[model samples]
Target: VIGVKRRVHGGLRFTIPVSPFDRIRALKQECDRLVAQAPPDLPVLFEQVLRFERMIAASGVDSVPSHADGLASNILIGPDGRIELVDFDGAGNVDPYYEIGILINEVFEDEKDFLPALEMFEGTPRPASLRRARLYAIADDLAWGLWGLVMDATSQRKDVEFYRYGFWRFIRCRAALERVDFGSYARML
Candidate 1:
């Protein structure tokens, strides 16, 4: 990663080419029933996330540290045009790649959109980080999928979209799991 000198014109990173069809505009559900019925794959994804984090820490990149939640709304562009990352509510010392992973997955949402954005941002893309991002993205999908089901079951918000959303997330998670050779990526741990 080239050392970036923060200049003014504070930019809030914006993703391009996101189709309206895939957007999850609100997170904004059921709690108990969904938890009880959550899929087994979610737990597997969590275990993988732990292994990925461990491997990333040992990869030896000078980490800027990880902010597990890199949601777009959490970032800001200062009035003076400087990039600002706020909301350190649960920030932690973690593999730097984890933060990028969160941001990339959040911005790209669909797998189809990831490569182009990655290539543009990274210039030529680094295998280690790109692979790591894959791990994180997979983990995120599983996590959100479970959360959606839980919220759908527990929340009073009677939107059937919650159920559909959970189903969609799980579908993506399964597809991603099939897509990546995580066993190879695990060796980095």
Candidate 2:
């Protein structure tokens, strides 16, 4: 990757796009939709949520370092569906859970199925397979929750609804944590 700096009247210049921010907002909407349709089996859901929370908490605490952004747009595909990650701006000192959360949200948004992705990551190491993805969902929710709050506080009234939606996600994540089988994820912590 290349980093560039521009001269601005004898000063340095830096520029950032608004797309990442927009992508973050879009991902949150997708996550909310999936969470609303999450299966009623509280035990399974709790286990998933608990696993995700542990991953997010650990990522935030710097236990592991992996690309924190795992969305369809960030994925570059080759023939036969081979793929590679294209963006790493949000990739520092982050939890695998946040990436999982984004993946879950995207899969659900596209296929309306969370089980397949969930199964894909099952039995994997903490922040390595499904556990990491699951954690991303929680971390993304938390991160977006803060983002939403910031938008609201800044008088971005159009984003208020999104912020509230994120708040609900945070609440659901907490509920999931409460219902999680701690034994499953405690080792990672």
Candidate 3:
């Protein structure tokens, strides 16, 4: 299958979404903002996952350039059924399997529910990649959780809805954290 990789000839005028590791502090600030706005009874699970992600960041990985923003909104389908990827704003050096986790978590309700996304990429995903995807999926949860908070903080038009969305994302992130087999994945490394 053929793929298109766009090349930029000069310095970009617009901002790009930095890779997750680089954006950790900003993301955490957003997470903190969300927590501050939330009630006292909010679950600690989101915090737990965020802390774990911080640990992962310090340990580090060899950055392989790939799309950091893989939300369903960025993908475009042609009339002839061909696929076109639109957003490169968040494309940069990061984990190779990064998008899989984002794609799986964003597009599916269950970890076991893998289909069109699983089929979208070439070859059956390996155990290592799947495991990494699971781990990264947890991270994606935190990212989206923070995103909701930003929306909640910024949007006047969707104030109530954004608050609900922010809290919901936190809850969702916590659930994904609970589902991760930390012990099993740790052993894999």
Candidate 4:
């Protein structure tokens, strides 16, 4: 048997007052802004995003799936900047790309810089990392979307705009998921 003790008092936590739902709402709004700004006939970009999502889902091998709760907030960074993961509450049965995608989303909000982070995370040009990151990013969107819904259900309608944002995120996530390359990722699972 193994036992782990809490290292720092209270451990790592964000100072941001926004709940997970608020963050998701913000992300959805940002996605909408980006999509609205895209060229009217940007099918190529959309196709590329789909291909990337497919690749990300396919990155992991069977038997050693990735951690499900790979969010940056769950990671504890020491004074020396080394990372220690906390709260494996959602652990197990995930693709390896899950962590990679989460990390990419946290550090690089800009789509342009996302590729570089993707390259570093995958450690190889598998092309699947792109798809995985996209999927993970969409997952982030979904997470926030649900968060907003939960807040609304709990009667926190003070932030109605957040719920609207969540709806937008859900729509965007669905759009992206529909184009994902499920075959590649499913084969590994």
Cand. 4 Cα-lDDT:
0.50
Off by over 4 Å in 1: 1-65, 76-87, 109-124
Q: Write the per-residue lDDT of candidate 4 for residues 98-126, one digit (tens) a residue.
A: 55555565556555676776565545635
Better of 1 and 4 by TM-score: 1
- Candidate 2 — which pairs collide? 52-135, 59-95, 97-135, 97-136, 98-135, 98-136, 100-133, 101-136, 101-137, 121-130
lDDT of each: 0.55, 0.46, 0.59, 0.50
Residue-by-residue lDDT tens digits, candidate 1, 56-136: 556654433333465678777778866666675535444445555666777776766666655654567666657876776
Stronger candidate by lDDT (1 vs 2) = 1
Q: Which candidate has the highest lDDT of all?
A: 3
Candidate 3 has a TM-score of 0.73
Better of 2 and 4 by TM-score: 4
Q: What residue runs in model 4 are displaced by over 4 Å at the alpha carbon?
A: 1-65, 155-189
For candidate 3, which ten residues in a row score worst on lDDT?
1-10
The clash tally of candidate 1 reads: 12
Q: How many backbone clashes does candidate 3 have?
A: 0
